[model samples]
Target: MEEAALLIDPEEIAALYRELCQFPSLSSACIGPEVTTQYGGKYCNIYTEWSQRDLERAENVKFCRQYLIFHDSQSIVFSSPSGNCTEIKGELLSRDSPSGAQKAVLRKITNSKGEEKQFLEVWEKSRKVKSIELTALEKHGQVYEDDQFGCLAWSHSETHLLYVAEKKRPKAESFFKPKAPELSNEEELTKAERRDKAVKGEQFVFYEDWGETLVSKSVPVLCVLDIESNNVSVLEGVPDHISPGQAFWTPGDTGVVFTGWWHEPFRLGLRHCTQRRSALFYVDLTGGRCELLTGDTKAIWSPRLSPDQCRIVYLENQASGPHQQCSRLCMYDWYTKLTSVIVDVVPRQSQGEFTGIYSTTLPERCWAADSQRVVLDTAQRSRQELIVIDTLSGSVCSLTKGCPLGSWAILTVDRDLLVARFSTPNCPPKLMVAFLPPAGKETEINWVCLEEASPIQGITWDVRTFQPPPEQINPQYEGLDFEAILLRPTQIPQTGKIPLVVTPHGGPHSVFTTSWTLYPAVLCRMGFAVLLVNYRGSLGFGQDCVDCLPGNVGSQDVKDVQVCVQNVLEEDPLNPQRVALLGGSHGGFLSCHLIGQYPETYKACVVRNPVVNIASMVGSTDIPDWCLTEAGLEYDQAALPDPAQWTKMLLHSPMQYVDKVQAPVLLMIGEDDRRVPPKQGLEYYHALKARGVPARMLWYPGNNHALSGVEAESDGFMNIALWLIKHLK
Candidate 1:
């Protein structure tokens, strides 16, 4: 491994990063795929948006407009959809009418003088556009853009629009400030007089918001816009304790149904946390009355209505336990007002059996033409597979079964035709369309490729499952096993064994699917084998697997990763002596633990926003509940930890074993990250430096926990490659 690292050129690594940036990733596909008569012939219309790196802007730019994808003589052709307009600037949210006759777009436009203004535009099918400037008084505050509390929806009649925004409040002012002079005429009062009447001394008040990625979003209120009258009004009677979002029109357009999150006790980090207490609610427009549609004890998400509007289907999970778990698919009958579980949570599963639904949310339009079958994507071990569930028969079938694609996701379902995106570790995402097969024949889908697969050269991948010996397995998780995807260069060096990089995903709850990920592929292209590990606690392996790591974090998860690496070394022709570690968040936590517990096993380590000391992090991180819960203790915001609890937390932290670390370390930190604060990395960096161990830290100013800004990611990856090359030797 040292010989191979010594032979690599730095210029080659930089070139590989630049080349990989050119590949566009699929951002989102528009729901309700259309079949129009004017677009050449009778062809399925698939619209998808893509995102790519913009090196000039130091950001990732999304092309939010639609692309027309159609089949033509054994090949797929891409073009612009009919009536597609030029992509708007600073567009925050957009929605189309049910009939596709009109479109509503929300944009934040800045004038030449640098004054920012919000505008709402309505475009008609006949090329007529109505643009309305929204003043601060009318909009209340900036629109919610994050997924947890943002919503923009059109009424069935298309005459009104409903969205979620910050609640209106009086501007804060100083209590002891001077009063404005009286104007001669009451009607000609100056601006200072108006400001004097506003509430005072509230600027410093701290209002808790939904944590992490959701910032400055404390109080979200539903607002409706009368398109014809050009008036906006906040919906009433939504209960002052809850924040509402994901709203849509009811069956008769007389009410709105949405998800309401309780903010009574406090708000925890909501992004990627499905266990937050939330429930379905219906608010009647005429009387301003609110009613609970689902019980308040469980978390619910994405209540998709059936095509016939007779029933609604949603996902439910435990409200306060694991952040991610096996969700139960539930349906609520509109007429009967009764909810039933269509698919219950599976505690455990045998090999190749249906584990359970492990998806955060379902697609906007997932119901089949018959309205009894629903199509959604879910994690099934090491891959993401598209599955269809029969609401009546309670039967589930995999639509992408027997297919080689490592990941499958539904884009939209138009009538019986389903549009989906699928990819493998070596292949980029491609579009495919398939007609829904009849019941019990879901696996026999004759898919028509809308786009050809673009496989990256010099990279090959295979999925490997690892199981511990009976004595080594945790007794509580007897049947538990883990999996890893090994990506290697197609042409290995003939002289030396290939160096290995063991990469674990961030969410201990998250699984590393055998999908096409850019960074891992880049490492393989650089002549390194990358092992993406999905440990015992990862999702898609049943609730038992997910529950295995919470009480046993820092030890069980660490051992599982070690077991995977050892098994891979025994089975494959990889150098065990040249092993390195790369991970972020909890994965980083595991990486830190590995180096300390088994210091001599790894040659180098790179951690991004790692959790170094849980005892210290519990007081600073956005999700304090995570610290206590993962440490096998119940979290109470009001109860402070005693010395005994602190000692236990410290025992599980990587800082306790810092003295045992042998590998040279590289710390990549996002300064503005809220999930795992930057101080976590700083503590580790300082500790290693004090001990005379080689260590380095790179801090990105505006990036978040993911360090996902295009420019930041590019520079970080380049630095990572260089650091690994320099130290592995």
Candidate 2:
């Protein structure tokens, strides 16, 4: 079969490229606002739409977006200030904004018997002197004599005002402080001199000029406000020892409540420390007494009572370690007053550390009803698997057949598991939902067709063919097979051929997928073919491939890309006489080495934030200490063979070979980057200048390593397109 020749014009190709660049990359829309998570249902679940500009600044920002709340198939909870307030059974509450300005709205319904219930609008607006008031259905009351206070939760029964009161120490009292004696060697006084005088004072000092207030004592109380008589009584003792954290009553609307708390000194240095401990304490409404059910050692998070109220299930840290363990499902029985671990498994762990070598792989966690069973997703080296655990029986079952390529491939809600399955990098991922039955054959799973999620835009791509002189259509490799996607330019003359752009992805650990891209289309539109290689160590190929990424295996990635480019050039003699290699970050590092190791292979190069010096990169990144620990290497040059091996790094550094780079180069960086700091880019730029090489540096002032901010992201892609046009010209 003869293939049709591509028709392309340089002007038309550039026009389409520009239009595509303006299109948004990817964005997520809710499955109609709120989806079911727990009682009252969880709100945000975004299903991504790909046509949106990923570079848009506001897209990442979370704001006051309206979501629908479903009460039943027939009735729904709509949040609208314009519509009349309706009444229904069960308590309805508005999610509060972080500012704490407007009081969160709540609607309480006793029954579904009638559509009409008494309308009420009770909220507290801030003013100079503060007072709390409640008015509903001709019933009203005022209760407060405090400077300021905030609402936590209004009683569902409308009997109490659960709130927190704050008071600051007087400026005059806090300003008076003891002076410290200066250390003097000439005058040695009493035992205090030999033992070093210890200063005693409050941790913070208040200054009139600074508008700072010292905190001496803070107390929180649950109060009952008499709606009829207009009287207020403090439910907790006046000089309360308890500092409530979260005080939400149980499911049955019982007088007994749960309050989260931690001891003060134990919480010391804790405000700055990432580790936190929160435990639930039982408080009595009728009797002004509170009993601590659990100590501060255990972390009680997201506590919820069962429908029967007999058992409470919560995610918490059950292990005895300085660092909190990945959360596990724990159950506390009301009757037994005993807390037991229902399911123990690692929740997600931080990236960078692939195995338990230095850090454990954080597993994905999901719990079944009564915490009897759990789904665990664990990743190692590079492979990931889904395991079902019968916590009670200590039995485990495998759910998916192949390992997950990346962490985003699996998700769980309640007992239902959603797995993203893809056979290869070129194939799109399919979403599969399944119910893991207890003992018998696992229920058959069905994949949700996501073709609607297509026309997925914002992918940068280049696709060129490799015709290997007609002698070989395919090449064989021992470890992995090669795959390719070729795009014939739309208007190039059939008498001749086109150029090839070889682009490598940034993260040595990341990959180029059929997931869609923005750059290659621009290249193809510009009358050139592109070859996107999902080389070894690229994600979506399972754990084994990922594990092969480290230890300078990037050479394999380079080999794959170079072979594809060479094969393409062999088929078309009218094709480009010169090939250009380009990438950012780790990819930039590879590009730098390519020009040094195989100088003749590429005609020119553009590198952004390249790691010219690996040892230097390790020492300068945000988590230098963590990186050192993970890479198992010292900062000193002796770590590499022949301490002068640092010279290989220097020789291969793009900066060192600026004069040797016969090709034009464009370098870029974000000034605020902590990872592969801007210095790396600047260093190369200066070197190119010294060598009088045809090079230019483009910089964004306050951008991070990824160029994440709105302006930075936009500038990044735009600069790349412009740079390519200059080189192609």
Candidate 3:
């Protein structure tokens, strides 16, 4: 380990980064293995490996990435490789509906492979009809598509529920334009005024009717479909002007649905409400009546039923003060209709401050496996831990005390505590199971290997010399020095100097942790020195650190990257001036800003769906207005800067900076994206071309904000890989 620390080589680091990048197989492995219970047997594991021969077998092996786990029953189950947004559907039913039985379909659409793969497993008594085999069905006038990204949700029960609420839209026009508000005086309104009103008024359209109905239309629906019984009816009609965000089913399998919606401030008129509103409604299945569960709760998430089905478990969110810094978790009783604050997790430092992101303290419904206890993994004031609260006793115990906190997923089993987690600064994640000895015994965690564990220590990494930052760092660091992990190559470099790739992550709210397998290591192996800094505004450090990065603090994150870039160049003068900046989402925004403002520093840039104009992004993107307020962007029209100020924003926009860029650029976008919509990419690409700059843009027609799904289009994969190799080399 000592020799490993001291023997840093620049070329080796670059090589390591390159090698890390070559693992197309690595991306395929991101979707977690299938863990399912076999009949009369324990849970089984299925892993996927990328084979070169398989590449030729599939239409587009690069885009044909899926982890297929065939169960004993011949049921194939696996997640997509991209590990982003995807719809993974499996059929537990027969190919066709039974002669007289309703369909029990198993379908899930999620962001897995950086895009959404829609999985459909229709359950029939004797056999299951899998959608993956539906290519032949597409010819039969049936088009079954799944959207794993943004607002892609399924209503529980036999009811076909559709909750299309009005959220934010990306910069693209994949969907219908927003409708203009209806004028009370129709005659008084001019033709132009009516057209504008139609454009601003949001509407809703079924997926099948995507074109006829405007994309901005938001109509919430809940329907019951029992083909065998010849019963297909819309259970309840959603309120016309308001969007219904989320809905859930009753345990009795009735059409009864619980729904909620969230509203943000507007750019003009009576916009800029101090706090957003979220309301919960219970719709009776038999009767088309919806009664308010509670009058306008601040926020609610993950409504689950108790074993008896008398009560419900939901997360009640409310801000402590105006700036929305404080947060509390409360429970609402369905029978009594009473709500009470159950947990106060927000720190005192954030109590009343008009400065922070304390939106949801816990992940969404921290309900336990058995529902008798609610578990919360919090790192608000200190390191993260698991706090289990017994509903009956109302007592809270720290289940994961002293455990290194990272993102955690709870494993459902009998009386056992199993967590899927990765420690800090690591790239790979691990699954660990702990046994609570009987009722009275002490708690002890035992490591279980769902998959073989391979820490960075077990893998080979390219080492590069790091020029350390100057002494006298922030005192917030306490006594710890900013540590460095160097990778060295096996052979000396003959090339003049190796290139450096600085890949920053998105989520000014999220941090880079040391968990399991990450792509940066591959970049190092590919012969490029990669530096991943957990800069300011990164989470897990503390609330204060995260709060510092919003708004202009984003520049601080960039500043930190600049210092690291200079440090690497200084330590290894052999390093070429061909440094590149790469990032996605927030990181993409940073990359765009960096090259735009400091074009001389970085050679080439690869930005994915970046939020270019902060004000426009706040007004248009899918993030909440409260989040914008916390970031110091004014919500009111009066507070907003004049269009002249927007010129300054345009200056920082990647589109404006293309003229000064010294290197080639690649813009990747998903057409259907709602987050940082595909339009942002399109606009930027057009701007670059207008400047006669060397720029290329690749768009995934049916893709969304995150390219979370895999497309069986080899053309898409090669486009990006070829672009990088051509420009980087």
Best by TM-score: 1
Question: What value does the lDDT take at residue 29 in candidate 3?
Answer: 23
Per-residue alpha-carbon lDDT of model 3 for 379-405, expressed as tens digits?
332223455556655555555554654
RMSD (Cα, Å) of model 2: 14.6
Runs off by more than 4 Å, candidate 1: 1-7, 31-44, 64-88, 126-128, 137-139, 184-196
Each candidate structure's TM-score, on Cα atoms with residue i matched to residue i, is 0.95, 0.50, 0.61
What's the lDDT for residue 614 in model 2? 53
* Residue range 18-78, candidate 2, lDDT tens digits: 4655543322222233355667544332132223333344233322222233323222233
Give the alpha-carbon lDDT of every model.
0.83, 0.46, 0.45
RMSD of each: 2.9, 14.6, 11.4
Question: Model 2, which residues run further than 4 Å from truth?
Answer: 1-443, 449-451, 456-498, 521-528, 539-550, 553-557, 567-578, 625-659
Candidate No. with top lDDT: 1
| Model with the higher lDDT, candidate 1 or 2 | 1
Model 3 residue 533 CA deviation (Å) reads 3.8
Better of 1 and 3 by lDDT: 1
